[model samples]
Structure formats: C-alpha cells, structure tokens
Target: MELEGDLFSLTNLRNMEIIDINTGAKLGFIKDLKINCEEHKIISIILPSQTFKISLFGKNEDIEIPWDNVKKIGVDVILVDGKNLVEE
Candidate 1:
C-alpha cells in the first residue's frame, strides 16, 4: 500500500484488519497510524476497539505496536509476531 502524501487520506486504509502471525487471529482494525517526526517513518499503529471493557475506564485505547514487531504487511491485514503481543 502506497501511503504517501496526505496523512489523513483514508482511501487506502479503511476497514483493514491487523492479525497475529502465530495464531492468525484478528486483533483489530487500523484506526490510525503514528509517524516519527524526525525519521518520517511509522512508529506505531492505532487500534480503536469495536467492543468496550469497563475496566478500561470506558475509553477506547489504541494498541501501540512498535514498528520493529511488525512481521509483515499484507493486502487485508498487518501481521505481527504473536509472542510480542500483550495478552488481555
């Protein structure tokens, strides 16, 4: 996916899913992306929840997966190493 130019452009990133490589489980959708200010590279991914938990204070938390853990980026999903993902 060629994500260049306008950062807010949702043309290429609507309804994309992020998956766990080890188990092939659907983690969440791509809510937004954080880019590094100096290097201009993607620093982390944002995953807004489709469901909510009361313990989380009723606010959606974005799952910040560091760029280094990303194993691959696929057409429909972004895959990451499962061992590094935090469990609930």
Candidate 2:
C-alpha cells in the first residue's frame, strides 16, 4: 500500500521523524530529499549523520535512505526497513 495518490508536502515530510523498524532506533529527521526530476519521483531521503562531528573522518556524513527501503509513512513517523542498520 504505497502513497501513490496521496499528496504530500515537503513541510509535512520534514516534520515527521524517521525510525528504523528493524532495530526500533530513531534514525533522525529529514534534512533533504533526493528526487528524480525527470521521473518526478523521490529517490531517497537524507538525514544528518548519527555520529558526532568529530568522527574519525573529521566530519559528519549525511545518511541517505533509499526510497525503496521505506516501509511506511505514518502521520507522525516514517518507518524504514533498515536491518542491522544501526548498532547502539
């Protein structure tokens, strides 16, 4: 049951928190979206890196979750199927 016909605004999406269904961990909120302009579809949703800014790489990396991995988009949260996606 995809949201094929439902209309959604970016603001509405930004307000919803993202959660990983598999691990039941709060991933983060949407910082941006990866959209396919030609196809007029969303490719993925971007989020701030869970790690600190002082990570080994010296900078935090953004997290990109493929649209296909999204299991459901509820009124308050977007559930994603990320198995072993985050530990701790």
Candidate 3:
C-alpha cells in the first residue's frame, strides 16, 4: 500500500517511531540519516541509543537500517523489516 500525505521533512521524520513489522518490536527513534548525495537519494536511516531503556553507559552502537527495508510511513510510526539486519 502506498502512503499518502504531504512530503515529510527531516524534522518530521525525527519525531516518528520506527517499528519492526516482522516482530512488532520497537526499534528506536531516528538519530541520523545517510544520504547518497550523488544519487540524490536516501541510503539508510541511522538509529541511536537503546529502545525503551536507559542504558547504564552513555553509549550503545548505532543501528544502521538500510532504506530498502523500510515498508511504510504512518502518522505516528515508520514500519520496517529488520529481520535481515546484521546484529552488532
């Protein structure tokens, strides 16, 4: 299904939650984006920090989600298939 709405700005995407469609798990909020400047396209979405927990340490490895895995963009959350993502 195609999503319909006004174009989303980076600021708008920042406020959205990312969910894994395969397991219905909350991934995390987007912390950064990787763009292919030469191709003028988004390469991946970068998620920082842990999901739903406060880590004792100040850092956890960032999760890099390839753009191809993204399935949908809803009003509140972004749906993605993360089953194939490599575990860090």
Candidate 4:
C-alpha cells in the first residue's frame, strides 16, 4: 500500500534540518520519530544526540520536538518553536 499527502515520505524528512522559527537557529537533523501507535500518528520528532559517543553507543539523549510545535514544513527545513517545543 501507499500513502499520499502534501508532506512527502519520512525518508525525505529524515535528512531535513529542523529550525527554530523564533530564534532562526538550526536545531538539528531529524534522527527518529515518536509515534502514537493507537492513533497511528506522529507524536514527536527526535533529533540527533548531542554527544557522538553516546550516539555511537546507541544511547541517544534525543531531543524530542512535539508535533504540535511544528509551524511549517518546507522542502529543506522544518520550522518549529524552539522556545517551547524543543525538549532540551
């Protein structure tokens, strides 16, 4: 089966950089996603870990950005509220 929407595949989104709409700072690249299995919806986006060693060890302190914070989804970057959404 296939899916369709204004948003493209998750593959396309993985490499896309996440940016803060308020600060205009590049947060990081999306590394994974948190899903609500019951609803079959994306709950949040997980950003790459800060430390390389931790990421290498497969213990990522991934920054999670709630889907509600997403303001815009562009071709190259996803705009979100850094002030509140980004879980540091």
The 10-residue segment of model 3 with minimum total lDDT is 49-58
Each model's RMSD to truth, in Å? 4.6, 3.5, 3.4, 5.0
User: What are the runs in model 3 whose C-alpha is more than 4 Å off?
Assistant: 49-59
Which of the two candidates, 3 or 4, achieves a greater lDDT against the reference?
3
Q: Against the unseen true structure, what C-alpha lDDT does each candidate score?
A: 0.64, 0.80, 0.82, 0.77
Task: Write candidate 1's Cα lDDT for 1-88 as tens digits.
Answer: 3323334435445466778778888887776777888997877776665356445566664566666777766566667765665322
> What's the lDDT for candidate 3?
0.82
Tens digits of per-residue lDDT for model 4, 1-88: 1123375788988878888889888888988899999999989998865555454556756688888888888777788886765444
TM-score of 3: 0.81
lDDT of 2 by residue, 1-88 (tens): 2453377789999998999988889998999898999999898888888877555867567788888888888878889987634221
Look at candidate 1 and give me any clashing residue pairs.
none
TM-score list, all predictions: 0.67, 0.81, 0.81, 0.76
Error of 4 at 6 (Å): 1.0
**Rank by lDDT (best first):** 3, 2, 4, 1
